[model samples]
Target: MQIILCESAEQVGRRAADIIEARVRQGPAVLGLATGGSPASTYAELIRRHREEGLRFGDVTAFTLDEYAGLPADHPQSYHSTIRREFVDHVDLDLAKLHTPRGDAEDLVAEAARYDLAIVGAGGIDVQLLGIGANGHIGFNEPTSSLRSRTRVKTLAVATRTANARFFEGDDEEVPKLCLTQGLGTIGESRQAVLVALGSAKAAAVQAMVEGPVSAFCPGSVLQLHPRATIVLDPGAASQLTMLEYYRDAQALNDGLQ
Candidate 1:
């Protein structure tokens, strides 16, 4: 695991986009994308590069991490629309190649299975982007979620729904109680995991995920076991990490070598 402490949220976004652009430049690549405010900046920067720097995503294949179980693909709040509005619509990425879990499928169980197969069939994700939930969940794999779990439908924890209420006109009750998400095991299979967090609100979860014990209670901690995982955070989010100075020193050394 590599921890990169940045001075601000925008820097964190730039750093993350740097990692992603490098992979896309390596040739055709499969990318696992996440939605929400945490990744909005990164997506924005990528869009800027595409428009101002000639960055191309024409050969990239993308997959969304999860979706609200009952939301239609056309719903404004659906991840399908969210991702497209936030990132896909701005880039040259082909809509046909962007795979998102069919949250509205009549048979979600089968849909989850098919989503997993689609990922594997695409040669696996070259780099998976992630966001650490304030409650330590990742892709809706809430507390106590099995470390070896696969893609599946999961009941939304109250806290998770509450946190997401902002997207639903500030009504927690309006948020879906169920969602289909990629499990920790499925996420860990990606070649590279890039998790980005910002603000003091995420400090504790960030600390636990990077420095605490590897337990299912904190799903994001599974990244600790990943062979290649990069954690990008702003100073506020890294505030609770005990080895803050060490991470900064290490990042400085890495920058020098590069």
Candidate 2:
């Protein structure tokens, strides 16, 4: 795993956007996108690029990682609406190329299977963007989740519901009980992955992901097994990491060498 410690959230977003732009330039990028607070700045930066620098999403194919089960696609808190409002509507991405798992599908299993097929049929994701939950979950693959699982509906852990309640007017009971998320195995199949984290609240989760043993307890740690995974974090999020300065300097030297 490679870690990039930025001075702030904006810096993290800019660096991540640079990497994403470079990948998109190589070819049509198949992006596995995540939603929530961590990615807000990154999405904003991408929108800025589109508006000011002629960056186009015309050839980009995007698949969102997860969505609340049973929520209407047009719901304000729905991942579909969030992505549309924050990124999709701001750019020129092909409407047909943007995909999200159907949260309200009657045949959820079939829908999930089709979603997985769509991702694989696109030659797999070129870059999967991730955001870690405070409890160390990624893409709603909560603690104790099977690592080899596939795309499916997941019952939200209580901690997850509580953490996500802020988006639903601080009412935990109103939060959806289940969600459709790509399994850890599916996420690990991507050619590359980037996890963006910020703030002191994320320090422990970041530390667990980067420094602790790879276990189901911390789904985010699965990134350690990926050949090309980047963890971009601000100083506050990197606080719990030991030898952080050394790692930062090493990354700088490696970039210089390249």
Candidate 3:
């Protein structure tokens, strides 16, 4: 795992966008995308690149990692709608290449399987973008979920529901009880992975993910097992990490004269 401590959230977002743009230029890049407040800045950065840098996504295909089951696709709080507003509408990506697990599908399992097949058929993801939930969940794969599991429906943890409540008229009860998410095994299949975290609220989770044992208690910790995973954090989020200063120096040296 590689740790990158950026000066601020915007820098982290720009760096993540740069890596994604680089991958998309190589070929038909398949991207594993995530939603939530943690990734909002990164999405903004990508939009900026698309508008100002001519970063095209015509050959790029994307699969969102998860979506709230039972939620209307057009719902403002739905992941599908968020993606459309933040990404799909901003870029020139082929609409046919975008895949979001159907929230209202009659057979969710089949939809999940279709998403997995699409990823496999595309030669796996070129880059997987992730956001670590406050409870350490990744892609709605809550704590205690099997690392080897595949895309499927999962019950939302109480913590997740509460965390998501802000988006749903401030009513925790309005948050969906279940979601469909790609599993850790699927995430590990990516050629590269980028996990972004910001703010002091994420400090504990960031520390657990970067330094703790790879246990199901903290799903984000599984990223440590990936061959190429980058964790980008703001200083507030890296506060609890003991080796953050070392990582900061290393990144400065690696990006020398930039």
Candidates 2 and 3 compared by TM-score, better number: 2
Per-residue CA lDDT of candidate 1, range 177-238, in tens? 99999989999999999999989999999999999999998999999999999999998899
lDDT of each: 0.94, 0.90, 0.88
Q: Give per-candidate clash totals.
A: 0, 0, 0
lDDT of 2 by residue, 1-258 (tens): 888889989999997888888888787889989999998889999999999998988889999999899987889999999899888899999878989998999987888888888889999999999999888999999998887877888899999999889989999999999999999999999999999999999899999999999989999998899999999999999999997978889889877997
In candidate 3, how many Å is residue 214 off?
0.5
Which candidate leads in TM-score? 1
Could you tell me which residue pairs clash in candidate 3? none
Error of 1 at 244 (Å): 0.9
Residue by residue across 1-258, what tens digits does model 3's lDDT show?
889888899988988887898888887788888888777888898888889988889998899999989877888878888888878898898888888888888898887888778789888888999999888888988999888878888999998898888888889999999888998888888999999999999999999999999989999999989999999898899899998668978888878955
RMSD over all Cα atoms, model 3: 1.4
